[model samples]
Target: MAEKVVMAMSGGVDSSVGAYLLKKQGYDVIGVTMQIWQDEKRCDIEDKGGCCGLSAVEDARKVCADLDIPFYVFNFKQIFKDKVINYFIDEYYLGRTPNPCIACNKHVKWEALLARALFMEAQYIATGHYAKITELKNGRYALQMDFNNPKDQTYALYGLTQFQLKHTLMPLSGIEKDEVRSIAKEIGLKVFNKPDSQEICFISDNNYGGFIEEEGGKKILPGNFVNTDGDIIGKHKGIVHYTVGQRKGLGIAFGKPMFVKEINPLTNEVVLSENKELFSEGLMASDINYMAVESVKEPMEAYAKIRYSHKPVLSEITAQGENILCKFKESQRAVTPGQAAVFYDKDGNILCGGVIERAV
Candidate 1:
């Protein structure tokens, strides 16, 4: 008998194609869609970018029908609100930025969805994530870099544990985005030409401050903007409205352009400084998950990316008990707290990653 594989279909072209590929591989393919949130209209079908949205479930259903597979919709709204959305709000409230996608992948897709797949007797759980898993000779699983486009590689997947990597499948790991779209078109999938969801699904607009204010029910008070010398130059709408390295929307006209150096939540102050202050030589991180190797007992040389869009820079990483220290070869700019710092080997294998604690 063929092994049963459950595919998390998001009603997107990539996941739709993933379902097709699994069925063609002769596996007992089962398509599962997670209903994670209720829409503003309280309708079963909404256009929200969340995977659990009604439209996505319908899309997955359509693909499953075409593939002659069974379809299931699991409601994960309460879990999503407690784990992902609440965590995001708490992080922002604490004056730290959080990546909801990372939390969603860690807690929702891997933990919750995988559990559901197992309950259904699935041998493997697959997704459209552009990542690869390799079994090494040492009898360990390694999450390798995607072969499609280096720029599109999601090194954030370093958080994946060996157990999860063992049963996880990424169909789009080797195929480029263009080719995936082409395949979807050839297969006559409805979402073949659909644009990728870029914004945080819960937030209809990108107004994070507005979301916080509406949810928290606390009006952000106006505060003073001070320079490095402790001189107040202008007034800011609120500390929550600014972030490190923010240049525009300051609403102040200085002789030269000034950028947000830091936000002091304690004092409700937004500090403006010259661009030079934004660059830092090193950082301390915690809440780390090491995948490629067992643990880092000493300092090891590797490439590190401070932000998602930034290129990886040469760095030496030292494990300090529960914390890790990353010393960059060159000064990196705007190393924001709460963002993850992912390490990689020269060959692009994910070493590990953690949340930024502080920058030096």
Candidate 2:
């Protein structure tokens, strides 16, 4: 009997093609779409507006039918709200910018969804993520970037444990997105030409501030904009409306260009300063997950990325109490709080990653 593999289908080209490839490879494939959110005001899933909508569910069902595989929808709305949505709101309220996608990958896809796949006695769970996993000696695994996809998603998957990596299969690791679409077209899948969903799966109109206030039930109050010298320059709309390194929408004209240097949620103050002040020498991160090595015993040189789009910079990381301190070789700008600081080896393999707690 062939091994059963549960495929996480998002009703998009990548996952649609992923299902097709798995079935063709002769695995007893099962397609599963997660119904994570269903808010009419935010996202109309019935209209195929977002990943979790009824439209996406139907599209995934059609693809499974075409491939002659079993299809199912798992309702993860409550778990998603508790884990990802609440965490997003809490981070923003604490004057930090959280990466919801990373949180969803850690708490939703790999955690809750993986558990469900195991419950069905599936040997492995697969997704369309453009990342690769290679098992080293003695059951150790390492996550690496997919060369075919320039938009590497390994940063979002740093939280994956060895157990999860062992049971996970990513079919699109070596396939480019365009090639995935081509395969989808050849396979006659309807979602072959579906435009990629850009917004957060749960946010309706991409109005993050509005959605946070409405759904999170948190009242973001107005505050004062202060400069580096501790002088009040102007009043801000709300502290939550701004982030570090932002310059354009301050609504204050200081004659010289200024950027958001810091945000103090407790004082309800947004600190403005010259663009040069945004650069930092280093940062401290917590909640670290290791992939390449068991642990860092001493200070060592590595390449680190503060955000998803940031180019990895040479750095020296050392253990600091319960957190890891990363000192960049050169100053880095806008090392925002609540963002991930992923460490990589020289060969572009993910070493370990953690939540950035503070800029040093």
RMSD, every candidate, angstroms: 2.2, 1.7
Please list the C-alpha lDDT of all candidates, in the order they appear. 0.81, 0.86
Q: In model 1, state the lDDT of residue 200.
A: 78
Residue pairs with clashing backbones, model 2 = 42-204, 45-53, 45-54
Q: Candidate 2's residue-wise lDDT over 1-360, tens digit each? A: 998999998877788888788888888899999988755556755443467777788878888888888999999998889999999988889999899999899888989988999999999999988888987664579898653467578888999998999899888887777888888888788788887767687876666777788777867798899988889999998776778899988897989999999989999999999988899999999999988888878997889999888888999999887789999999999999999999988877777899999899
Candidate 1's TM-score reads 0.94
**Which residue pairs in candidate 1 have backbone atoms (N, alpha carbon, C) closer than 3 angstroms, thus clashing?**
none
Alpha carbon lDDT of residue 257, candidate 2?
94
What's the alpha carbon RMSD for model 1?
Answer: 2.2
Candidate 1 residue-wise lDDT, 34-121, digit = tens? 8887574432234444455777788789988987899998888888988988888777766777888888888888889888898988
Q: Clashes per prediction?
A: 0, 3
In model 2, state the lDDT of residue 43.
71
